[model samples]
Structures are given as structure tokens and as C-alpha cells.
Target chain A: MLIMKNINKIFQTADIQTHALRDFCLQVNEGDFVSVTGPSGSGKTTFLNIAGLLETFSNGEFLLDGEDVGKLNDNGRSRMRNEKIGFIFQGFNLIPDLNLYDNVDVPLRYRGFNAKERKFRIEQNLERVGLASRMKHLPSQLSGGQQQRVAIARALATDPRFLLADEPTGNLDSEMAQSVMSLLEDINQQGTTIIMVTHDAQLAQRAKRTIQVKDGKVSELENISRQHNQAIA
Target chain B: MLETGLILRALARNKIGALLIALQIALTMTIMVNAIFMIQDRQQQMQRKSGLDEKNSFYLTNTVFGQDYNIQAHLQTDLHTIRNTPGVVDAIQINAIPLSSSGWSMALQHEPGEDKDAVGTAIYMVDDHAINSMGLTLVAGANFQPEDVELRKEGQSTWPAKTIITQAFAENLYPDNWQSAVGKTVYISQTQPIQIIGIVAALQAPWNGWNGVERSMLVPFQRESKGSYYFIRTEAGRRDELMPIIEKTLAESDKKRIIRRVTTIEDTRERSYRQHNATNKILTTVVITLTLITGFGIVGLAIFSINRRTKQIGTRRALGATKGQIMRYFMMENFIISTFGIIIGCFGAVALNMWLVNTFNLSPISFQLVAFGVITLFIVGQLAVLYPARKAAMIAPATATRTI
Candidate 1:
């Protein structure tokens, strides 16, 4: 589970102070699919960054799996990120020079997995994403949708309990975006909590809950999947 | 360990930059090792002891430019006055000063035939006071007696029968046992049988660049010539004060001869090796400049590589690579590149050394020095890349999410 309370992120420059996130309270439980939606410069990416521990906030209370994140040192944060969290960026963020196999091996190497274990996970994840045959190909050799699948395979290779994806399908067409959304749904069904940031309304509805960010603050939107489950119970 | 193979694969794809730097390192090692070797060779040559009381001894030339003067009687008078003066230890009339770059050399053989191979040695013409005046240690035999001294006229072809040889020349003549050379008779001038009556521990020849610089021989000779050198050894702490006094006394005692070239052995040694010292300085400058250029080359290449891979580094950081791991990545990359350079450099250094050995007739380079080169270049390469690696480590992981 991931929880945030009154998280504040202020970017200070020589001449300007930009508040990226303010009072950003959030809670993501196990096996929950949450999508964050906002316009450009609305703190959507900042929330994802703070949640992923890619950047520190100015003042905040962040708890990941019941451990206080603010108290963790840099190495502690990196260990938590390696053992429990994974990330997928909109641009695929695949190392251009590395082939699919080596690209997927990056995090597993950092995770301290043995050669045999890393190979098994790399093969299994590539197979799950339906790109097992193209494991030796570089990212440029693949189409737009294929690269995102490879990215998703890399994210899942470490068996992370929580996955943070920033616009996972933003660079894809409608058909490719829908396919990646279906892949994410399948991952969430396997007991992985996911928080994805996007601007697509259709993709937002597919999640169990949705939040909208405006001017460095967050507000809950309608929760169709939660409401449907409550009605059935 | 796992990063090695991955970094190698990545470098294989971008081989140009790394290959260029490797070649630079190879060339640097080649010139650097050989230059140091040359400098060491010259330094060894310059450090040889000339077997003189160099600090307490000085010599001056007495040129007879007038007629109707008894040169032999005045020579004795001058020696008597200089030796009886205050603070004077002993004095002699020497044919040449060691390490002065001008002297006489004669070849000696066991038999009286020119067909046999002869060992060459520098010849010093001095009398019984020679051992004390030059501060030479009699390692094996005795010094020349006063009765053994002889008067040698100008253009004399014959040599004195008794002579004292340095241990090095004794070894050359009697390679089996140098102490046996004390009573051995060696034929000089191909036929003149000269007995080695004594053996000094060491006495360098006048010509420092000669291969057999440590081989010298002293003969008992009081020369009767138009020009000669008066070599004097003063008491401790008195040479500097006595240098001018002795020159003045010798000048005033003889109106027919002019006292000139009043020089200390120390000054002669410095003047003798000035060229070696200059060459060593030049080679040192070259080594320093080459090393610095190679270091800057490494820094430039690492910085360019880090700038190109900023986003990749950020993505790796986001994927759970710690800052230390990020720094190690670049450092390991440089290590791999440096390993390649060092391999080529080893071969390049040896090849260059072989050429130098063949061309310059120097000894083959030492393995320890080559190993030293390897360690030094490796350290240089790593230190050169440190700042750029740290800069790459400082890259924020949020950069992976940026569109621009």
C-alpha cells in the first residue's frame, strides 16, 4: 500500500519559486488500479514523481508499505524502489543502444538477482508481453506499440508490488493505447497496485478510481468501478 | 561484474570514441616509458663518483710562455712551496683531472704482441703523493714509494715499470680475481711491461661518457714539460679559502709561466655532465606534457559520453540504480576502455623499447618499470573520469519523464 498526506513540493530557482505539489493526499491499496488525470503543468507528473521517489518533496508525509518514506536515506529509498516499486515512462525510456534483453536486465541487475533468476524473469515477462521472439532486437527496431510492451515487460521483470507509469500509452495510437491499457489491466489483476498518470478520459474510466490534479492540488472524480462493486455487495 | 559485459556491448556499438582514446593512451605509454628510461640512464651516468677529494681539491694549469727558465727546478720549487704552506694536505703534478673530458688512454694486454685483445684504461701521471692528494683508497696493494717516482720528459714513448690501477681496471685485466692483479704484469703500449703495484677501490676516467669510465691507472711520473697542472688537496674547510691563495702564490713564484684555469673538481664534474642534465630535463618535460594531455583527453571523452547519455543514466537511476552505482557505471566503462588501452600500450611500449634498444644500444627496459607504467596510466584514466562520473550520478531521475 502507498499513502501520502499533505505532500508539498516547491522547486526553487535563483529568481522564481514554483509550487509543483501542495497538500497532495493520496492512498493506493493493494490490487487497486488508479489513474491520475490533469492538464499540462497541473502537478500530475509531479505526483507520480513523488510517489515513485524519483524526486523529494519540500515537506510531506509519505508512507510506502507502512514504512515512512521521509525517514529513509538515499540508499534506503533506492533499495525500496528496487525491491518494491517499478516505473514506466511515456517515451518508453528504453536505452537505445541496448537490445530488448539487456534493457530488461537493467533493473534485475540492480535488484541483485542471480543470472539464472534474472534470465527466467526476463524471458517470462517478455513472453507475457508477447515479445519473447524479439528479445534480441533494439528498441528502434520495434514499432510504437511494441516498444511500450517492452517497457511494460521491463517494469514487471522485478515482480514489483507497486508500479508507477507516467503516460504509458501517450505516444501510441488509439488501438495501441487500448492494447497497452488491456495489458496494464491484466497486470493489476495479478495483485499488483498501479498508479498511472494520463489525460485520456476513456483510459481514466477503466481504473477502479480516478483523481484530477489542478494547480498543484488533487480532487477525487467519480469512481465507477468502486461504485459498481459496492452496489453488487 | 555484470556491468562489464553490458558496458562492453554498449561500447562495441559506439567504438569510435573509445578507440581513439585507447590509441592516445597507447602512444602516450610508448613515449612515456622510453623517455623515463633514457632519463634514468643519463642520471646513472651522472651519479658516478670520480674518486677525488672533489670538495677539498682544485687544479690549475701552468703554461710557460717565456724562455731561459729552468722548468724542472721551478716545478719542484712550486710543489715544495704549495705543499709546505698552511692547511695543505699534499700536492702533485697530475697529467689530467678525472671527469675533465680531456685525457690520455692506453691499451694493455697480457703479452707483448699487438695481435692480442687489450683492455683500455685512462692514464694518470702522478708521484708518491698521488694516493693522498687524490684521496683514493688503496683497496689491495700499497701506494707508490718515493724511490719509484721517475722524471718523464716531453714526447717520451716509454712508461714507468710500476703502476697503480683501479679495481675496475684490475678486474678487466684479471677477471678471475682482482686481488691477484696486485703483482700481475700487464704490457702497455703493446710491449712495455707495466706491473700493477696497487689497486684502488674506484677512480673514474676523465671521459664520463666512456663505457669503461671507472677504469684508471696511476703511474709514478714527474713530468718535465712546457705546460703542466698542479693538483693540490687542502685540509678540511680550507679548499675554498686556499684556491685563490695557491693560484696567487704559483703566479708570483714563476714569472716565466702563467697560472690559468684554476678549477675545482666539482665544477669540472658539473660541466662534464651538463649535456646529460639538459637532456634529462627535456625528457622530463616531455613525459609531464604527454601525461597531462592524455589525462585531459580522458576527461573530455568522459564528459562528452555522459552528456550524450543523460537520459539513459536518469532512467537507470529511476529503475533503482543508486548514486554510487551510477558513478560506478561510468567508472567501469572507463576501466574497460583503459584495459584495452593498457593492453595495446604494453605491446606498444615493448615495441618502442625494442626499437630504442636496437637504435641507441641501450639495455632492454625493465619489467618492473613497465608494470609501473600500467599502474600509473590506470590511475590517470580513473582520476580523469571521476568528475564526469559524479556529474552523471547527480543527474535527476525525473529527467526520464521529460519530453524535451
Candidate 2:
């Protein structure tokens, strides 16, 4: 559901130029799960940003749900992002002032859903994430894992075409991370495309495919079992 | 609606800042209300009637020649020359002009037949024509005639023959009926007893701020009288033309003795009005300046406030709010803040106007003042909100995903 070809992002100051992304590429198909792994300064975050329409690429062609994202203005990009993409941030960036239910309902409201429909969708999403009983609780009132679940619930409530998760379990403990990863896998099993960026090799090994980025370029694209068999041979 | 609610919630977070703005609005409004009241007070002072028909009248200080000219001959010559001037309608030679700040007064005790003792009235030695020339209405006896000035005719008494009493004097002693007040006796001092020939309405002196004084009583000029002025009515718009002729007709010696100021009666009225309005004009300017500064201050602060909340605005924008919605959010937020201030300010204004009325003896309340207050507050609100709302509306949703 997402595609990027020869995407480049460069930051220029008066006397300094930094290449954030160069010759970067990414693709995610329907019902497929993909993980991108990199160190701190790699172009993985930049690729995810361009793919999700959060940042513009300097020289690139991005097709999101088959529409040319590079041609969209700020407002048009925002509209497409709201309608077609769900973001799960490493910080679990739920609005602190809102309760869990309203946090999940926010994107739905932007989609012009009425009050009754928004309530129903928010409750169903919260139930799907096993947080139905905590709908009225604040983010600060929940544990790290519960908050990530709320974030996931928020992402799925809008029924976006694809999910873009940037370090979804970066702040969680091992147990919480595994639960979030299992929940993400179940969502993928239910036929939703998820593109997650992480630095954890163990978590990257669980995805259908793992892409390693280094120095603003993709260093390796490996499948899970084939790489293991090749290592055994 | 949701956007506006969001703005209000943000404003509520900075309660102290909002309160400061409210206080500024209230204080400025108080100053505005007082300034308006002071202007109205000045207007009332300007329009208040001075008891004479100051229009068409001019004063000339004409002096008789010779140390021993004899008041009777001097008066006859001056009156005859002045009456024949081209634009001359009527003239009076008097010791004091009505409504002028300068005047002469005498304390009188009631004689055997009079009702009161020790009543003071302004004394003016006027000829027969001074009454009608000054446009004074007679409520009783006939005005003194030229024939009564027997010193110029035959052998008339020159000491004191008759006098006109002002209505205030009549009201003081008689309490009713100027007729009974007339035909009574009054003495300028212990020596002179003048019969009352006419009772005229009270005259307002032009320079006085208010009415209700015994203006002037008329009498024929006596030989002992000296240092008197003449009031002449030259047709409206013709005073300038009459000045040179009047100068030519008076004795050359008298011309040099014309020490008084002369101008149109309209100018005199405006002079009186100008004095009363000086404070009001100054107050108005100050109030207007302060209100404008406060309004711009509000605009500047609102811009700063919206800039600080850009992330919140971007989030709202990302939630499908239109530009118009964001604009209305800021505008409505400011309107609520201004409204609260205006309501409090109205009370403050009332208290201030009342204090001015009670302490300073300023002008009374006028009904139109409320409309001015409301309009000023609304204007402040709109001007303060316009640029801020526009800026808020222009904030892009991309800002939400970017590092705050």
C-alpha cells in the first residue's frame, strides 16, 4: 500500500550540508509486515517520515495508496495522512488532556464521523486492544504497555490503509515489548499492513522481512528463514 | 465550536495573563467614561444661557472731555452722537454691563415702607434706552424716559429720580408680584432714595458661569458719575463698519480713553465656552490615546499568545478544522476575554461618573454614554483578535508531527 523510489532528503545550512536520506527506497504491500533496523544516524526514520507524508522528500516519487504524495500541498498531505495512515510513535504520543477513548476517537473525528459512530468505533477498537475497561483512563494512569496498547487502539480506530510505527516498543520493558509485538503481529494476521522501525534485532527477526539501513542508504534486505538457512549452510 | 473550546481551554491555563489584560481593559474603560462625561459637562456649560442678548451688541468706553464737563452735558452729547450712527439701533451708558464679571454693588436697608433690610443689588446708572436696548423684558412699571432726565430738559432733579429693579431683587423682598415690588422705595445707601419705575427680569452676566444673581438696576446718569461704558447694538454683521464712525463721532479725547476690549458678541460667547471646555478637550485626547494603546497592546499580546499555542492549533487543524474555524477560535476567545472586562468596566465607569458628579460637581448623567462604552469595547475586541486569528488559521498541520 506504500511505495518510495530514489527518495532523497538533504538539510542545508549556510556553510554545512547534511544528507539525511539518499537513494532510499521502501515498499509495503497489503497484509505484509516489514521492519526497518538501523543505528541512531541511519536514514530509517527519514524513510519512514517520507513514506508517512510527515516530511517532504527532496527528490523522490512517493505513491501512497496509489496517489502521488509529492504533488500534494501541506493541506492535501495532511488530509491524505489523516485518511490513509496511522502513526504509532516511540513516545506513545497520545494527547495528555484526552481520555483513552477520546484519544482513539480523535482521528475518527477528523474523518468526519458523527458522535454515535465515533463512540462505537472507539469502544470496539479499545476492546480489540484489550483496553475496553480502561476507556476513560488517562495515559498517565496506564502502564507503559497499556499506553502502547492505547496508542495502537488509536492508530486502528481510524481504519487506516497502512500503519507506520516508529520504534513502537522503544520505551517498554521486555514483557511489555513482547506483548506489543504480539499484538502488532495479530493485527498483521488480520490483513493490515504494518511498517515498523526498530533497532532491536530480535524484534526485527520476527517480521516477515527486515531491512537494515546504514549511512543514509539501505545496507541489506533479508528474509528471516532464508538468511538462517544460508547461515547454517 | 470544538476549536473555540480548545482556545478557551488554553487561555484558561494562563489565568494571570488573562487577568492582566482584563484589568487593562477595565482601567481604560473607566478613563474613557470619565472623559465622555467631562465633554458632556463642557457642552452643557457652553450652551447655558447668559442672561443677555449678547448678539448685535458691542461695548465702547467713551469718555467725556474736560475735568468739569458736567455729567449731564457729557451724557447728552454722547447719546445724540451715538444714536445717529449709521448702524446704531439702541445704546445705553451704564456704570456696569450686565453679565460682565466687573460690576458695582450697594448695600441697602429697607426704608419705612419697604419689606427687607440689607439687600445688595448691582447698581447701574443707565439712560431710558438701556432697558429695551439690552432686550430686558419688563414684568412691571414703565421704563425711565429721556424726559425724566430733567437736567438736560428743564430743571429736573439730578440726585436720583427713579430706578429699575431686577426680578431677583423683586423675588427676594416681595416673594410674588413684581407690581407690588415696584412703586416701593429703595436707597442705594443712607443718602439716596430712588423710586422704582420698572421691574425687569433677571439678566445673566456674560462672563459669569451660572445664573441667579441680581444683574443690574438702571438709573439716569448723574453729574458726579464717572468712568462709565456705553453699550451699542449695531445691526448684526455690521459691528466692524460701525467702529470707525463711532470713533469719529465721539470726542477726540474720548477716543483715546476707549480702554475696553471690543469684538462680536458671538466671540464673547465662544470665549466663555472655550474656557469651560479646556479640561474636557484635554481629557478626551488622553482617553482616546490610552484606549488606542491598550487596543494595540491587546493585539500584540494576542499574537504572542497564539504563537505560543501553535502546536495546539496545528493539532486542531489536523483534526479537519477549516481555516475559518481556527480564526473563529482565536476571535471568540478574545471576545470572551474582552466581554468579561467590559462588563466589569461598566460597573467601574458607573462608580467613576458618580464619584465625579458627587466630588467634583461635574455634569449629570447622559443616556447615550452607555452606547459609547459598548462600542468602544467591541472595537477593541475585534482589532485585537483579527491578526492573531489569521495567524492561528494559517498554522499548518505539519507542525504537529514536527519537533515542537
Model 2: residues >4 Å from true position, as ranges?
Answer: A3-233, B47-76, B88-90, B93-229, B240-258, B319-322, B360-367
lDDT value, residue A6 of candidate 1: 96
Q: What is the C-alpha lDDT of each candidate?
A: 0.91, 0.74
lDDT by residue (tens digit), candidate 1, B169-269: 88888889999998889899999999989999999999998989999999999999888899999998899999999999988887788999999888999
Q: Give me the displacement of residue A166 in model 1, in angstroms.
A: 1.3
Models 1 onward score TM values of 0.95, 0.70
Report the alpha-carbon TM-score of model 1 versus the true structure: 0.95
Look at candidate 2 and tell me the lDDT of residue B4. 41
Measured with C-alpha atoms, the lDDT of residue A201 in candidate 1 is: 82
RMSD of 2: 7.0
Alpha-carbon runs more than 4 Å astray in model 1:
A226-233
What's the interface RMS deviation of candidate 1? 1.2
| Complex DockQ, candidate 1 | 0.67
DockQ for every model, please.
Answer: 0.67, 0.19
Fraction of native A-B contacts kept, per candidate: 0.67, 0.14
CA RMSD of each candidate after superposition: 2.3, 7.0
